[model samples]
Target: MSVTPARTGARPARWPTGVGRLVAGAALLTAVALLPWLSGTDPALTVLRALSADQDPTPAQLAAVREQLGLDEGPFSHLVHWLGGLPRGDAGTSWVSGEPVLPQVASAFAVSLTLMLGALAVTVAVAALVSARTLYLGSRRRLHRVRAGTGAAVLAALPKFLLASLLATVCGVWLDWFPSSGWEGPQSMVLPALALGVPSGAVIGGLLDQALPAAFNEPWARTWCAYGFPSGLTARNALRRTLAGVLPQLLPTVVALVGGAVAVEKIFNIPGLGRLALDAAMAQDLPPLQTATLFLVLLGVTAGRLLQALRHALLGPALRDGALATLHQPALPRRRSPRRVAALCAAALLTLVVAGLLRDPLHVDTAARLMPPSAAHPLGTDSLGRDLLARLGHGALRTAGVALAVTAVSAAAGLLVGLTARVGAGLTEVASTLPAVLAGLLTTAVTGPSVWGAACAVCLVAWTPYAAQAAALLEEERASGHLLASVSFGAGPRYLLRHHLLPAVLPALLRNALLRLPTTVLVLASLGFLGLGEQPPTPEWGRLLSENQPYGELAPWTVLAPAGALVLLSVLAVSATPSGRSGTRRSGAAS
Candidate 1:
């Protein structure tokens, strides 16, 4: 009998490196410098207001400020001037404070960095514990894995802002165990770090949980197991190999943490770079915003490089030997009745919408303010005396509707680009590093905060993930034997694509889109929570949470109602994931 040798050292996805990386970084910086012009806000007017909010300066005064700030030149000139001062450690001056931008940016960056590090540590710890628990349950307890996965998905669905609100209310205000707000000491950091880290850790844990089992199922692993090797030794080797495949996901998780920190910092009142950027954007302070953007971009680049180095270190000899398994698609657990769960969640959401439509979301009763749940108010009443049930129900339609629209548009655009464009990977990599919150800041800069601005900001980067997935699928399909055979039989490019590619790629992309719905909702909510979405009198899920946060201790139901709705929506999305067979196929192709 002939034995087939194992495929060793599966190579990870490649990203821009060396000179290419430098070019990418430079291009991003240039774009950042041009943001003032892109925003279309008059810098002189903005500066005048920042300098003296009540003063209405004359054209001559505006011109003087303009000339003093070197705004007489084009946007490109700003980039050149900023670049010229970099070597000497100059980062220009802040328009709002008139202080050195570098010092302010540095101080904010340090605080944000500390928060990020703490969050990362929390992420690592959570992922490790979850993964360890799931692995301990073993394959025989498939039901346990399903429950664990559901828990993780639910946890991952919890938005940082919502979590921050809950932690502040329960742990900080009610229990008085920790400080609810401010950056006074280490205790204040706990809530924000947990809020950011727990959800992210759940995501990472899910990835690890999926990857580890897949790695163990490899032929080499089975062979070792059959040879009487200690289970622990074999498990350790499988884990090392799994890490090599899972490292790529760290980039997205890191980006999420950074993006989430915006709301987290806001909620905690921490002076992080995210809050600094947000404040600068709100005030139209270009210098500080630009500097903060620069720092964030640098941090992302640094993270990417470090992850690459770690991947290399983990793979080592296996990289050359092809012993490591390629990254696998995480399969949805099969034993559980996800369809039933999805159906229930959907019905519940629809009921909320229908019930809300019958009620008056805008009606306010000052006498009934902060009323607890009763027959009159199914959920409760907010501080404003508005019915929580009505607001949640009505807000569901707006939040879910906008999220669906954005996801559909993003998926369609991504599919088109991924199937046709060769640069999909590069674009995805670049866009993945940019948080939607930051994009919202940019959009707000131009469009002036509104629902459409938040939607537009989300659309900017949401499509990249779909595009990357489609591109990978296309590449895999092109290399398939069946595709080559069809080509040899005189199949035209149009025929090949229409008959072969679209059918094969569309379902998976759609499924991917569905899985991403919760994330979309969360991002949109994050924007609303930050006051970048719909203005007052508008009942957005995020805005509701934000507006009621102050009263969380007094009337916890006000916050819980919206938070619960979001959690249910997330569950609905996760429960709708397709079966494992498709995931297995995708993983096989990827390998």
Candidate 2:
């Protein structure tokens, strides 16, 4: 084989350039800026509702309110007026509080920035240590590999809010090592940071584990290994390559972090942007919500671009391209039986359905209250004497229904958006920036606490990541040689999508679905925890966890049973997806 020489200075031909991303970012911001008017709630009514909740306003009162807020003007006029103020640094005023949006956001920014930075630091440190340990151990012992894998999965599987609660209960209430919830000082930031960071670190560690071996197998890396270099040095270089390889893949994780922070902030009672976003969305306060959404989009776009730039600067274009090529050309997966995995997942789903259909979760028995596990109650009875097993079944059923609905909507919407990337880029950006918690809260504000509302909210924000993933896969497939030949052969867009595109996209779609389930469950649970999901006596998994948390010590089973089930189901969902090698594959057609 002939050797190819390295180039001195050339832009990475694959993926979007900085200028393209900037244009996309601008487009995304514009789409998000119009959300206030596009949300279907009358801005005048939202303001009126905020201003006067006790009494109904007449037509004349509505008219006066409309004129006062300039809602009488057309949408274009309103849009122009709002857009015009951006150059002057005016973000408009919060309809509810009558204060300037910028000041409110600015004050809250410091707390959120601190929390995020602390969490980031914790994430990097923990990920590096765990990844290093895993790499070293995974090479030496099978048991070590198993242990490391198990630990990473378990850590990653735990929901952030649940983790937060457990940490607060253990460290704050029981051990008294720290305050349970606050934003007082740097000391108060530790628990929340850990709560957020540990799971992320675990995820990163797992990714590193997958990437390090490949990096080590490279010729140059192997030569270095043969030399006197330490394993740590090899691992460090592997990490650099691994991060470069995984940067685009981490978008979903980054989105989840920003989105989930709202719930985490709410739980820890930190007065950050997350909490502010929730509060603003709940009140349907357009000005603040718009400003928050814009800020979030800006932060996300800016951070992503900066990260890409930094990586390019550090690695140089040639090395970065090589790393990316390695990532794109994943090795074939081990020949594990897909049918076996499918059967197990199917069995678990069927059991959930049967238990839900057969059980009566609402039944009461005062005498059996707070009973420990026994033949009569496999999972024990709650403080209210309701059988925990039955409640869990019913809760699982409800959660499953929500998960199914949300997943279906998200998957469908994502597929559409993914296929039509140029048209959907604006939408993807808006949804990605708008956190799930904030979306859920906004839905609750509009629809009130109910199952449908919860589903809508989760779907509203959850679809974008799937869309982005689909779009990315679509782009890759489109670039493949066969697709161009098929196009040249006069294949219509529809035929190409159905035959060539769908097959190439299927694996990722399935993966996205499975990965999204746990996050969806957690978001619903967080809403339930906050009393904005399922309402009372609904027996949703999250509602059960929330209602029973106060009595965690009094009857640990009440809390642990549901929490355990959530974790187990999440694990099962994750396990169900195929972890086969990456890269595009033809499915439905010969192309």
Candidate 1: segments with Cα more than 4 A from true spot: 1-27, 138-148, 173-176, 184-186, 210-213, 216-229, 312-334, 408-429, 445-448, 463-516, 529-531, 581-591
The whole-model C-alpha lDDT of candidate 1 against the native structure comes to 0.69
lDDT of 1 at 25: 57
lDDT per residue as tens, model 2, 494-577: 787787678766665665466446557767877777666777777877777767776777888888877766656655655555
Question: Would you list the C-alpha lDDT of every candidate in the order shown?
Answer: 0.69, 0.63
Q: 301 in model 1: Cα distance from truth in Å?
A: 1.4
Worst 10 residues of 1 by lDDT: 2-11
**Cα miss at 349, model 2 (Å)?**
8.5
Name the lDDT value of residue 89 in candidate 1: 95
Model 1 Cα displacement at 517 (Å)?
2.8
In candidate 2 the C-alpha lDDT for residue 143 amounts to 19
